[model samples]
Target: MTDRRVQKTKKAIREAYLSLILEKETPKITITEIAQRADIDRKTFYLHYDSIEDIIHEFGRQETEALILHLEQNDFFDDTADMAALFRALNALIEANLELYQHIARTPSYAFLWGQIKDILKVSLTETMGERLDIPRAQLEICAEFYASGTISTYLAWLRGDLPMSDDQLAEIVGDIAYYGLHKLISPPKAEGDEG
Candidate 1:
Protein backbone atom coordinates (compact mmCIF):
# COMPACT_ATOMS: atom_id res chain seq x y z
CA MET A 1 0.00 0.00 0.00
CA THR A 2 1.20 3.49 -0.76
CA ASP A 3 1.36 6.19 1.89
CA ARG A 4 -1.34 8.85 1.96
CA ARG A 5 1.26 11.58 1.55
CA VAL A 6 2.60 9.88 -1.56
CA GLN A 7 -0.87 9.64 -3.02
CA LYS A 8 -1.52 13.30 -2.23
CA THR A 9 1.74 14.35 -3.79
CA LYS A 10 1.03 12.36 -6.93
CA LYS A 11 -2.45 13.81 -7.20
CA ALA A 12 -1.07 17.32 -6.89
CA ILE A 13 1.44 16.63 -9.58
CA ARG A 14 -1.26 15.31 -11.88
CA GLU A 15 -3.50 18.28 -11.18
CA ALA A 16 -0.65 20.68 -11.88
CA TYR A 17 0.28 18.98 -15.11
CA LEU A 18 -3.33 19.00 -16.28
CA SER A 19 -3.71 22.72 -15.50
CA LEU A 20 -0.46 23.58 -17.25
CA ILE A 21 -1.34 21.61 -20.34
CA LEU A 22 -4.56 23.54 -20.69
CA GLU A 23 -2.73 26.86 -20.80
CA LYS A 24 0.15 25.74 -23.02
CA GLU A 25 1.46 22.78 -24.95
CA THR A 26 3.08 19.95 -23.04
CA PRO A 27 6.36 20.51 -24.85
CA LYS A 28 6.47 24.09 -23.59
CA ILE A 29 6.09 23.12 -19.93
CA THR A 30 9.07 22.67 -17.66
CA ILE A 31 9.75 20.70 -14.51
CA THR A 32 10.14 23.98 -12.63
CA GLU A 33 6.71 25.19 -13.60
CA ILE A 34 5.17 21.87 -12.70
CA ALA A 35 6.89 21.82 -9.36
CA GLN A 36 5.81 25.38 -8.61
CA ARG A 37 2.22 24.74 -9.65
CA ALA A 38 2.13 21.54 -7.67
CA ASP A 39 3.71 23.29 -4.65
CA ILE A 40 6.39 20.65 -4.50
CA ASP A 41 10.12 21.00 -4.85
CA ARG A 42 11.90 19.99 -8.03
CA LYS A 43 13.50 17.12 -6.14
CA THR A 44 10.11 15.92 -4.98
CA PHE A 45 8.75 16.11 -8.53
CA TYR A 46 11.74 14.12 -9.74
CA LEU A 47 11.06 11.53 -7.09
CA HIS A 48 7.58 11.01 -8.49
CA TYR A 49 8.20 11.44 -12.24
CA ASP A 50 11.18 11.63 -14.54
CA SER A 51 9.70 14.18 -16.93
CA ILE A 52 6.48 15.77 -18.20
CA GLU A 53 6.22 13.12 -20.90
CA ASP A 54 6.25 10.47 -18.20
CA ILE A 55 3.44 12.29 -16.44
CA ILE A 56 1.34 12.42 -19.60
CA HIS A 57 1.98 8.75 -20.30
CA GLU A 58 1.02 7.81 -16.77
CA PHE A 59 -2.11 9.95 -16.99
CA GLY A 60 -3.15 8.20 -20.21
CA ARG A 61 -2.56 4.80 -18.65
CA GLN A 62 -4.56 5.74 -15.58
CA GLU A 63 -7.44 7.11 -17.67
CA THR A 64 -7.64 3.90 -19.69
CA GLU A 65 -7.46 1.82 -16.54
CA ALA A 66 -10.29 3.79 -14.98
CA LEU A 67 -12.40 3.22 -18.10
CA ILE A 68 -11.75 -0.52 -18.06
CA LEU A 69 -12.57 -0.63 -14.38
CA HIS A 70 -15.84 1.23 -14.96
CA LEU A 71 -16.76 -1.18 -17.74
CA GLU A 72 -15.95 -4.25 -15.67
CA GLN A 73 -17.83 -2.96 -12.64
CA ASN A 74 -20.90 -2.18 -14.75
CA ASP A 75 -20.81 -5.60 -16.50
CA PHE A 76 -20.51 -3.58 -19.68
CA PHE A 77 -20.97 -6.39 -22.17
CA ASP A 78 -23.35 -8.50 -20.10
CA ASP A 79 -26.75 -9.43 -21.54
CA THR A 80 -28.61 -7.00 -19.31
CA ALA A 81 -26.54 -4.01 -20.41
CA ASP A 82 -27.00 -2.68 -23.95
CA MET A 83 -24.80 -0.47 -26.10
CA ALA A 84 -26.58 2.70 -24.98
CA ALA A 85 -25.78 1.91 -21.39
CA LEU A 86 -22.15 1.48 -22.37
CA PHE A 87 -22.08 4.83 -24.12
CA ARG A 88 -23.86 6.51 -21.23
CA ALA A 89 -21.37 5.11 -18.77
CA LEU A 90 -18.58 6.40 -20.98
CA ASN A 91 -20.18 9.82 -21.27
CA ALA A 92 -20.61 9.99 -17.53
CA LEU A 93 -16.94 9.29 -17.02
CA ILE A 94 -15.87 11.87 -19.55
CA GLU A 95 -18.20 14.53 -18.21
CA ALA A 96 -17.04 13.87 -14.69
CA ASN A 97 -13.53 14.76 -15.78
CA LEU A 98 -14.32 17.20 -18.52
CA GLU A 99 -11.42 19.54 -17.93
CA LEU A 100 -8.83 16.77 -17.80
CA TYR A 101 -10.13 15.22 -20.96
CA GLN A 102 -10.23 18.56 -22.74
CA HIS A 103 -6.64 19.20 -21.77
CA ILE A 104 -5.71 15.76 -23.05
CA ALA A 105 -7.53 16.38 -26.32
CA ARG A 106 -5.34 19.44 -26.87
CA THR A 107 -2.14 17.66 -25.89
CA PRO A 108 -0.63 15.91 -28.89
CA SER A 109 1.41 13.46 -26.82
CA TYR A 110 -1.75 12.11 -25.26
CA ALA A 111 -3.40 11.46 -28.61
CA PHE A 112 -2.73 7.73 -28.30
CA LEU A 113 -5.19 7.60 -25.39
CA TRP A 114 -8.03 7.79 -27.90
CA GLY A 115 -6.57 4.91 -29.91
CA GLN A 116 -6.05 2.89 -26.75
CA ILE A 117 -9.70 3.25 -25.81
CA LYS A 118 -10.71 2.42 -29.39
CA ASP A 119 -8.64 -0.76 -29.38
CA ILE A 120 -10.20 -1.81 -26.08
CA LEU A 121 -13.65 -1.28 -27.51
CA LYS A 122 -12.74 -3.33 -30.56
CA VAL A 123 -11.53 -6.23 -28.43
CA SER A 124 -14.67 -6.08 -26.32
CA LEU A 125 -16.82 -6.16 -29.44
CA THR A 126 -14.86 -9.05 -30.85
CA GLU A 127 -15.18 -11.02 -27.66
CA THR A 128 -18.90 -10.36 -27.45
CA MET A 129 -19.82 -10.80 -31.14
CA GLY A 130 -16.96 -12.65 -32.77
CA GLU A 131 -18.42 -16.12 -32.38
CA ARG A 132 -21.67 -14.99 -34.00
CA LEU A 133 -19.93 -13.26 -36.86
CA ASP A 134 -19.79 -14.84 -40.30
CA ILE A 135 -17.89 -12.04 -41.96
CA PRO A 136 -14.22 -12.15 -42.84
CA ARG A 137 -11.72 -11.22 -40.11
CA ALA A 138 -10.71 -8.04 -41.90
CA GLN A 139 -14.32 -6.95 -42.28
CA LEU A 140 -15.03 -7.42 -38.60
CA GLU A 141 -11.96 -5.42 -37.73
CA ILE A 142 -13.11 -2.65 -40.02
CA CYS A 143 -16.55 -2.59 -38.41
CA ALA A 144 -15.07 -2.35 -34.95
CA GLU A 145 -12.73 0.42 -36.05
CA PHE A 146 -15.63 2.36 -37.53
CA TYR A 147 -17.66 2.23 -34.34
CA ALA A 148 -14.68 2.88 -32.08
CA SER A 149 -13.38 5.85 -34.06
CA GLY A 150 -16.83 7.34 -34.42
CA THR A 151 -17.53 7.09 -30.70
CA ILE A 152 -14.10 8.45 -29.75
CA SER A 153 -14.46 11.35 -32.14
CA THR A 154 -17.85 12.10 -30.69
CA TYR A 155 -16.51 12.10 -27.16
CA LEU A 156 -13.57 14.31 -28.17
CA ALA A 157 -15.96 16.73 -29.76
CA TRP A 158 -18.01 16.74 -26.59
CA LEU A 159 -14.92 17.43 -24.52
CA ARG A 160 -14.00 20.34 -26.75
CA GLY A 161 -17.47 21.78 -26.21
CA ASP A 162 -18.15 21.52 -29.92
CA LEU A 163 -21.21 19.32 -29.40
CA PRO A 164 -24.29 21.21 -28.31
CA MET A 165 -25.92 18.08 -26.88
CA SER A 166 -25.70 17.08 -23.27
CA ASP A 167 -23.97 13.86 -22.29
CA ASP A 168 -27.24 11.98 -22.13
CA GLN A 169 -28.34 13.39 -25.46
CA LEU A 170 -24.99 12.56 -27.04
CA ALA A 171 -25.09 9.08 -25.58
CA GLU A 172 -28.51 8.47 -27.07
CA ILE A 173 -27.38 9.80 -30.42
CA VAL A 174 -24.32 7.55 -30.50
CA GLY A 175 -26.30 4.52 -29.39
CA ASP A 176 -28.90 5.20 -32.04
CA ILE A 177 -26.32 5.60 -34.75
CA ALA A 178 -24.47 2.46 -33.71
CA TYR A 179 -27.56 0.28 -33.49
CA TYR A 180 -29.61 1.77 -36.33
CA GLY A 181 -26.89 2.86 -38.74
CA LEU A 182 -27.45 5.86 -41.04
CA HIS A 183 -30.98 4.93 -42.06
CA LYS A 184 -32.51 7.64 -39.89
CA LEU A 185 -29.52 9.92 -40.22
CA ILE A 186 -29.76 10.11 -44.02
CA SER A 187 -32.93 11.70 -45.28
CA PRO A 188 -34.84 10.26 -48.20
CA PRO A 189 -33.83 11.94 -51.46
CA LYS A 190 -36.04 15.03 -51.82
CA ALA A 191 -38.67 14.81 -54.50
CA GLU A 192 -37.75 16.80 -57.59
CA GLY A 193 -40.47 19.31 -56.78
CA ASP A 194 -39.50 19.62 -53.08
CA GLU A 195 -37.54 22.75 -52.22
CA GLY A 196 -36.29 23.94 -48.84
Candidate 2:
Protein backbone atom coordinates (compact mmCIF):
# COMPACT_ATOMS: atom_id res chain seq x y z
CA MET A 1 0.00 0.00 0.00
CA THR A 2 1.11 3.57 -0.56
CA ASP A 3 2.16 5.67 2.46
CA ARG A 4 -1.13 7.60 2.38
CA ARG A 5 -3.13 4.39 2.17
CA VAL A 6 -1.24 2.92 5.11
CA GLN A 7 -1.94 5.94 7.25
CA LYS A 8 -5.59 5.95 6.24
CA THR A 9 -5.97 2.28 7.02
CA LYS A 10 -4.37 2.68 10.41
CA LYS A 11 -6.61 5.63 11.21
CA ALA A 12 -9.67 3.67 10.22
CA ILE A 13 -8.57 0.70 12.28
CA ARG A 14 -8.11 2.90 15.32
CA GLU A 15 -11.50 4.52 14.89
CA ALA A 16 -13.15 1.16 14.46
CA TYR A 17 -11.36 -0.18 17.51
CA LEU A 18 -12.56 2.73 19.60
CA SER A 19 -16.10 2.40 18.29
CA LEU A 20 -16.14 -1.30 19.06
CA ILE A 21 -14.83 -0.66 22.55
CA LEU A 22 -17.59 1.84 23.23
CA GLU A 23 -20.26 -0.56 21.96
CA LYS A 24 -18.93 -3.66 23.71
CA GLU A 25 -16.20 -4.84 26.02
CA THR A 26 -12.71 -5.27 24.61
CA PRO A 27 -12.74 -9.08 24.90
CA LYS A 28 -15.84 -9.23 22.74
CA ILE A 29 -14.37 -7.13 19.94
CA THR A 30 -12.79 -9.06 17.08
CA ILE A 31 -10.24 -8.19 14.44
CA THR A 32 -12.60 -9.29 11.69
CA GLU A 33 -15.27 -6.97 12.99
CA ILE A 34 -12.84 -4.10 13.26
CA ALA A 35 -11.76 -4.68 9.69
CA GLN A 36 -15.37 -4.80 8.56
CA ARG A 37 -16.14 -1.56 10.30
CA ALA A 38 -13.04 0.11 8.92
CA ASP A 39 -13.91 -1.06 5.40
CA ILE A 40 -10.53 -2.76 5.23
CA ASP A 41 -9.50 -6.37 4.89
CA ARG A 42 -8.43 -8.44 7.87
CA LYS A 43 -5.03 -8.72 6.27
CA THR A 44 -4.71 -4.95 6.29
CA PHE A 45 -5.66 -4.80 9.96
CA TYR A 46 -2.96 -7.39 10.69
CA LEU A 47 -0.46 -5.30 8.74
CA HIS A 48 -1.22 -2.47 11.15
CA TYR A 49 -1.78 -4.12 14.55
CA ASP A 50 -1.01 -7.52 15.98
CA SER A 51 -4.24 -7.64 17.98
CA ILE A 52 -6.88 -5.48 19.55
CA GLU A 53 -4.92 -5.26 22.78
CA ASP A 54 -1.94 -3.95 20.86
CA ILE A 55 -3.97 -1.08 19.52
CA ILE A 56 -5.32 -0.29 22.98
CA HIS A 57 -1.85 -0.44 24.49
CA GLU A 58 -0.44 1.82 21.79
CA PHE A 59 -3.25 4.29 22.30
CA GLY A 60 -2.70 4.31 26.04
CA ARG A 61 1.04 4.77 25.61
CA GLN A 62 0.67 7.67 23.19
CA GLU A 63 -1.90 9.44 25.36
CA THR A 64 0.09 8.88 28.53
CA GLU A 65 3.29 10.19 26.99
CA ALA A 66 1.56 13.22 25.57
CA LEU A 67 -0.05 13.95 28.94
CA ILE A 68 3.29 13.67 30.68
CA LEU A 69 4.86 16.06 28.22
CA HIS A 70 2.03 18.52 28.57
CA LEU A 71 2.25 18.46 32.36
CA GLU A 72 5.99 18.99 32.32
CA GLN A 73 5.78 21.82 29.80
CA ASN A 74 3.19 23.56 31.92
CA ASP A 75 5.21 23.09 35.16
CA PHE A 76 2.24 21.21 36.52
CA PHE A 77 4.37 19.16 38.89
CA ASP A 78 6.33 22.07 40.23
CA ASP A 79 6.88 22.37 43.93
CA THR A 80 4.66 24.89 45.70
CA ALA A 81 2.25 24.79 42.82
CA ASP A 82 -1.49 25.33 43.04
CA MET A 83 -2.77 21.78 42.75
CA ALA A 84 -6.21 23.08 41.78
CA ALA A 85 -4.66 24.34 38.58
CA LEU A 86 -3.13 20.95 37.92
CA PHE A 87 -6.44 19.24 38.53
CA ARG A 88 -8.28 21.71 36.34
CA ALA A 89 -5.82 21.16 33.53
CA LEU A 90 -6.23 17.42 33.93
CA ASN A 91 -9.99 17.84 33.84
CA ALA A 92 -9.65 19.85 30.67
CA LEU A 93 -7.59 17.13 29.04
CA ILE A 94 -10.15 14.50 29.94
CA GLU A 95 -13.02 16.73 28.84
CA ALA A 96 -11.33 17.26 25.49
CA ASN A 97 -11.08 13.50 24.98
CA LEU A 98 -14.29 12.56 26.79
CA GLU A 99 -15.28 9.86 24.33
CA LEU A 100 -12.03 7.95 24.49
CA TYR A 101 -11.84 8.20 28.27
CA GLN A 102 -15.46 7.29 28.87
CA HIS A 103 -15.08 4.31 26.55
CA ILE A 104 -11.88 3.21 28.27
CA ALA A 105 -13.44 3.61 31.71
CA ARG A 106 -16.31 1.32 30.74
CA THR A 107 -14.22 -1.31 28.98
CA PRO A 108 -12.92 -4.60 30.38
CA SER A 109 -9.42 -3.32 29.70
CA TYR A 110 -10.00 -0.61 32.31
CA ALA A 111 -7.43 -2.11 34.62
CA PHE A 112 -4.76 -1.74 31.96
CA LEU A 113 -5.79 1.85 31.39
CA TRP A 114 -5.86 2.49 35.13
CA GLY A 115 -2.41 1.00 35.54
CA GLN A 116 -0.98 3.30 32.91
CA ILE A 117 -2.70 6.28 34.49
CA LYS A 118 -1.43 5.31 37.95
CA ASP A 119 2.12 5.02 36.69
CA ILE A 120 1.96 8.53 35.29
CA LEU A 121 0.48 9.82 38.54
CA LYS A 122 3.30 8.12 40.39
CA VAL A 123 5.80 10.06 38.30
CA SER A 124 4.13 13.34 39.16
CA LEU A 125 3.88 12.45 42.85
CA THR A 126 7.51 11.44 42.98
CA GLU A 127 8.53 14.73 41.46
CA THR A 128 6.44 16.66 43.95
CA MET A 129 7.43 14.74 47.11
CA GLY A 130 10.71 12.94 46.36
CA GLU A 131 13.15 15.42 47.82
CA ARG A 132 11.06 16.41 50.79
CA LEU A 133 10.05 12.91 51.79
CA ASP A 134 13.30 11.16 50.92
CA ILE A 135 11.25 8.01 50.62
CA PRO A 136 12.27 4.86 48.82
CA ARG A 137 10.69 3.99 45.49
CA ALA A 138 8.76 1.09 47.02
CA GLN A 139 7.17 3.33 49.65
CA LEU A 140 6.56 6.07 47.14
CA GLU A 141 4.82 3.57 44.90
CA ILE A 142 2.47 2.67 47.74
CA CYS A 143 1.56 6.30 48.21
CA ALA A 144 1.11 6.76 44.51
CA GLU A 145 -1.14 3.72 44.24
CA PHE A 146 -3.28 4.87 47.12
CA TYR A 147 -3.86 8.30 45.69
CA ALA A 148 -4.01 7.22 42.07
CA SER A 149 -6.67 4.60 42.72
CA GLY A 150 -8.81 7.09 44.58
CA THR A 151 -8.41 9.72 41.90
CA ILE A 152 -9.12 7.28 39.06
CA SER A 153 -12.18 5.87 40.75
CA THR A 154 -13.50 9.31 41.42
CA TYR A 155 -12.85 10.42 37.86
CA LEU A 156 -14.49 7.30 36.49
CA ALA A 157 -17.56 7.96 38.55
CA TRP A 158 -17.58 11.52 37.31
CA LEU A 159 -17.19 10.39 33.71
CA ARG A 160 -20.12 8.01 34.10
CA GLY A 161 -22.26 10.92 35.31
CA ASP A 162 -22.55 9.45 38.77
CA LEU A 163 -20.80 12.39 40.40
CA PRO A 164 -22.64 15.67 40.21
CA MET A 165 -19.72 17.99 40.95
CA SER A 166 -18.44 20.32 38.25
CA ASP A 167 -14.79 20.27 37.15
CA ASP A 168 -13.58 23.02 39.49
CA GLN A 169 -15.52 21.60 42.40
CA LEU A 170 -14.08 18.16 41.82
CA ALA A 171 -10.64 19.62 41.48
CA GLU A 172 -10.94 21.38 44.82
CA ILE A 173 -12.18 18.19 46.44
CA VAL A 174 -9.34 16.11 45.04
CA GLY A 175 -6.75 18.69 45.93
CA ASP A 176 -7.99 18.84 49.50
CA ILE A 177 -7.96 15.07 49.75
CA ALA A 178 -4.40 15.00 48.51
CA TYR A 179 -3.05 17.65 50.86
CA TYR A 180 -5.19 17.39 53.99
CA GLY A 181 -4.02 13.87 54.81
CA LEU A 182 -6.30 10.85 55.22
CA HIS A 183 -5.67 10.25 58.91
CA LYS A 184 -8.41 12.62 59.92
CA LEU A 185 -10.90 10.84 57.73
CA ILE A 186 -10.08 7.39 59.07
CA SER A 187 -8.58 8.00 62.44
CA PRO A 188 -8.74 5.82 65.50
CA PRO A 189 -10.39 7.21 68.59
CA LYS A 190 -8.10 8.22 71.41
CA ALA A 191 -8.31 6.30 74.71
CA GLU A 192 -9.70 8.26 77.65
CA GLY A 193 -6.26 8.42 79.29
CA ASP A 194 -4.39 9.45 76.18
CA GLU A 195 -2.72 12.89 76.25
CA GLY A 196 -3.45 15.56 73.66
Candidate 3:
Protein backbone atom coordinates (compact mmCIF):
# COMPACT_ATOMS: atom_id res chain seq x y z
CA MET A 1 0.00 0.00 0.00
CA THR A 2 2.78 2.39 0.86
CA ASP A 3 4.53 1.69 -2.42
CA ARG A 4 1.40 2.43 -4.35
CA ARG A 5 0.80 5.63 -2.42
CA VAL A 6 4.31 6.74 -3.09
CA GLN A 7 3.84 6.10 -6.77
CA LYS A 8 0.57 8.01 -6.77
CA THR A 9 2.07 11.01 -5.00
CA LYS A 10 5.05 11.06 -7.34
CA LYS A 11 2.82 10.77 -10.36
CA ALA A 12 0.62 13.56 -9.04
CA ILE A 13 3.61 15.81 -8.51
CA ARG A 14 5.00 15.16 -11.98
CA GLU A 15 1.64 15.72 -13.60
CA ALA A 16 1.19 18.94 -11.68
CA TYR A 17 4.63 20.11 -12.62
CA LEU A 18 3.94 19.44 -16.30
CA SER A 19 0.66 21.33 -16.16
CA LEU A 20 2.32 24.26 -14.44
CA ILE A 21 5.24 24.25 -16.86
CA LEU A 22 2.83 24.49 -19.76
CA GLU A 23 1.52 27.73 -18.29
CA LYS A 24 4.62 29.25 -16.67
CA GLU A 25 8.34 29.03 -16.43
CA THR A 26 9.89 26.54 -13.98
CA PRO A 27 11.73 29.28 -12.13
CA LYS A 28 8.46 30.87 -11.12
CA ILE A 29 7.13 27.64 -9.57
CA THR A 30 7.41 26.48 -5.97
CA ILE A 31 6.55 23.54 -3.74
CA THR A 32 3.48 25.28 -2.46
CA GLU A 33 2.34 26.00 -5.99
CA ILE A 34 2.90 22.39 -7.01
CA ALA A 35 1.12 21.07 -3.93
CA GLN A 36 -1.84 23.24 -4.69
CA ARG A 37 -1.84 22.23 -8.31
CA ALA A 38 -1.60 18.56 -7.39
CA ASP A 39 -4.16 18.84 -4.59
CA ILE A 40 -1.60 17.52 -2.16
CA ASP A 41 -0.18 19.04 1.01
CA ARG A 42 3.33 20.35 1.44
CA LYS A 43 4.12 17.33 3.57
CA THR A 44 3.07 15.02 0.76
CA PHE A 45 5.31 16.85 -1.65
CA TYR A 46 8.29 16.57 0.67
CA LEU A 47 7.55 12.91 1.29
CA HIS A 48 8.33 12.13 -2.31
CA TYR A 49 10.70 14.90 -3.36
CA ASP A 50 13.45 16.99 -1.84
CA SER A 51 12.50 19.89 -4.06
CA ILE A 52 10.91 20.73 -7.38
CA GLU A 53 14.29 20.25 -9.00
CA ASP A 54 14.51 16.74 -7.64
CA ILE A 55 11.27 15.79 -9.29
CA ILE A 56 12.38 17.44 -12.48
CA HIS A 57 15.65 15.56 -12.38
CA GLU A 58 13.88 12.27 -11.84
CA PHE A 59 11.53 13.11 -14.69
CA GLY A 60 14.49 13.64 -16.98
CA ARG A 61 16.00 10.34 -15.89
CA GLN A 62 12.79 8.47 -16.50
CA GLU A 63 12.43 10.07 -19.91
CA THR A 64 15.95 9.11 -20.93
CA GLU A 65 15.46 5.57 -19.75
CA ALA A 66 12.39 5.28 -21.91
CA LEU A 67 14.33 6.62 -24.88
CA ILE A 68 17.09 4.08 -24.36
CA LEU A 69 14.65 1.21 -24.17
CA HIS A 70 13.03 2.43 -27.35
CA LEU A 71 16.39 2.66 -29.04
CA GLU A 72 17.50 -0.81 -27.98
CA GLN A 73 14.30 -2.40 -29.19
CA ASN A 74 14.85 -0.76 -32.56
CA ASP A 75 18.26 -2.49 -32.84
CA PHE A 76 20.39 0.51 -32.02
CA PHE A 77 22.65 -1.97 -30.28
CA ASP A 78 23.21 -4.07 -33.43
CA ASP A 79 26.58 -2.38 -33.90
CA THR A 80 28.66 0.19 -32.14
CA ALA A 81 28.20 2.43 -35.18
CA ASP A 82 24.45 2.02 -35.50
CA MET A 83 23.43 5.41 -34.17
CA ALA A 84 20.50 6.07 -36.49
CA ALA A 85 17.89 4.61 -34.11
CA LEU A 86 19.39 6.52 -31.24
CA PHE A 87 19.11 9.77 -33.18
CA ARG A 88 15.55 9.00 -34.28
CA ALA A 89 14.50 8.27 -30.72
CA LEU A 90 16.18 11.48 -29.60
CA ASN A 91 14.35 13.52 -32.22
CA ALA A 92 11.01 12.07 -31.14
CA LEU A 93 11.78 12.82 -27.49
CA ILE A 94 12.68 16.49 -28.04
CA GLU A 95 9.62 17.07 -30.16
CA ALA A 96 7.39 15.49 -27.51
CA ASN A 97 8.72 17.65 -24.68
CA LEU A 98 9.46 20.89 -26.47
CA GLU A 99 8.04 23.04 -23.68
CA LEU A 100 9.82 21.06 -20.98
CA TYR A 101 12.95 21.14 -23.12
CA GLN A 102 12.79 24.90 -23.28
CA HIS A 103 12.32 25.07 -19.52
CA ILE A 104 14.91 22.47 -18.54
CA ALA A 105 17.46 23.84 -20.98
CA ARG A 106 17.29 27.05 -18.97
CA THR A 107 18.24 25.29 -15.73
CA PRO A 108 21.39 23.65 -14.37
CA SER A 109 19.63 20.32 -14.62
CA TYR A 110 19.81 20.65 -18.39
CA ALA A 111 23.18 18.94 -18.31
CA PHE A 112 21.61 15.82 -16.85
CA LEU A 113 19.72 15.17 -20.05
CA TRP A 114 22.78 15.24 -22.26
CA GLY A 115 24.80 13.42 -19.62
CA GLN A 116 22.26 10.62 -19.58
CA ILE A 117 22.40 10.29 -23.35
CA LYS A 118 26.18 10.12 -23.32
CA ASP A 119 26.19 7.41 -20.71
CA ILE A 120 23.57 5.41 -22.58
CA LEU A 121 25.52 5.62 -25.82
CA LYS A 122 28.70 4.58 -24.07
CA VAL A 123 27.06 1.49 -22.60
CA SER A 124 25.25 0.53 -25.80
CA LEU A 125 28.36 1.01 -27.90
CA THR A 126 30.40 -0.96 -25.41
CA GLU A 127 27.87 -3.78 -25.60
CA THR A 128 28.20 -3.95 -29.36
CA MET A 129 31.86 -4.95 -28.98
CA GLY A 130 31.52 -8.66 -29.85
CA GLU A 131 34.95 -9.65 -28.63
CA ARG A 132 36.24 -6.33 -27.40
CA LEU A 133 37.65 -3.63 -29.62
CA ASP A 134 41.09 -4.26 -31.03
CA ILE A 135 42.29 -0.81 -29.94
CA PRO A 136 43.71 -0.04 -26.52
CA ARG A 137 41.04 0.48 -23.85
CA ALA A 138 42.10 4.10 -23.44
CA GLN A 139 41.93 4.71 -27.17
CA LEU A 140 38.49 3.11 -27.49
CA GLU A 141 37.27 5.22 -24.59
CA ILE A 142 38.40 8.35 -26.36
CA CYS A 143 36.65 7.36 -29.58
CA ALA A 144 33.39 6.51 -27.80
CA GLU A 145 33.54 9.78 -25.91
CA PHE A 146 34.07 11.70 -29.13
CA TYR A 147 31.21 9.98 -30.91
CA ALA A 148 28.77 10.52 -28.05
CA SER A 149 29.75 14.18 -27.76
CA GLY A 150 29.29 14.66 -31.48
CA THR A 151 25.83 13.03 -31.33
CA ILE A 152 24.66 15.19 -28.44
CA SER A 153 26.11 18.33 -30.04
CA THR A 154 24.22 17.72 -33.25
CA TYR A 155 20.90 17.40 -31.41
CA LEU A 156 21.66 20.50 -29.40
CA ALA A 157 22.34 22.39 -32.60
CA TRP A 158 19.04 21.17 -33.97
CA LEU A 159 17.29 22.43 -30.84
CA ARG A 160 18.92 25.83 -31.30
CA GLY A 161 17.71 26.08 -34.93
CA ASP A 162 21.22 26.07 -36.34
CA LEU A 163 19.89 24.27 -39.42
CA PRO A 164 16.66 24.57 -41.37
CA MET A 165 16.37 20.77 -41.42
CA SER A 166 13.52 19.01 -39.64
CA ASP A 167 14.32 16.54 -36.89
CA ASP A 168 13.98 13.46 -39.12
CA GLN A 169 16.07 15.10 -41.80
CA LEU A 170 18.57 16.13 -39.19
CA ALA A 171 18.69 12.58 -37.86
CA GLU A 172 19.23 11.18 -41.33
CA ILE A 173 21.87 13.76 -42.07
CA VAL A 174 23.60 13.00 -38.83
CA GLY A 175 23.44 9.27 -39.55
CA ASP A 176 24.99 9.87 -42.96
CA ILE A 177 27.73 12.00 -41.51
CA ALA A 178 28.50 9.58 -38.72
CA TYR A 179 28.42 6.51 -40.97
CA TYR A 180 29.67 7.84 -44.30
CA GLY A 181 31.77 10.86 -43.31
CA LEU A 182 31.34 14.56 -44.23
CA HIS A 183 31.53 13.97 -47.95
CA LYS A 184 28.17 12.21 -47.72
CA LEU A 185 26.42 15.39 -46.57
CA ILE A 186 28.50 17.92 -48.54
CA SER A 187 30.25 17.88 -51.87
CA PRO A 188 31.87 20.89 -53.55
CA PRO A 189 29.23 23.03 -55.21
CA LYS A 190 29.22 22.91 -58.97
CA ALA A 191 29.15 26.01 -61.19
CA GLU A 192 25.72 27.43 -61.93
CA GLY A 193 23.72 25.25 -64.34
CA ASP A 194 26.39 22.54 -64.15
CA GLU A 195 25.00 18.99 -64.39
CA GLY A 196 26.39 15.65 -63.36
Candidates in order, TM-scores: namely 0.82, 0.78, 0.81
For each of the candidates, the C-alpha root-mean-square deviation to the true structure, in angstroms, is 3.7, 4.6, 3.5
What's the CA error at residue 98 for candidate 1, in Å? 0.9
Residue 184 error, candidate 3, Å: 2.2
Better of 1 and 2 by TM-score: 1
Local distance difference test, each candidate: 0.79, 0.78, 0.76
Candidate 3 colliding pairs: none
Across 41-130, the per-residue lDDT of candidate 1 in tens digits comes to 999998999877788778767766777778778886664236776687687667777877877876567778788777777776665555
Compose the digit string of candidate 3's lDDT tens values, residues 84-114.
Answer: 6667887777888876675555545468767
Show the lowest summed lDDT stretch of 10 residues, model 3. 124-133
Give lDDT: candidate 2, residue 57: 85
Best by lDDT: 1
Clash pairs of candidate 2? none
Scored against the true structure, residue 102 in model 3 reaches a CA lDDT of 54
Instruction: Estimate the TM-score for candidate 1.
Output: 0.82
**How far off is residue 187 in model 2, in Å?**
15
Q: TM-score for model 2?
A: 0.78
Evaluate model 3: give its TM-score. 0.81
Which candidate number has the best TM-score? 1
| Residue range 107-183, candidate 2, lDDT tens digits | 65477877887788777876776656877988977887787778878888887778998878898878777766665
Residue 87 lDDT in candidate 2: 67
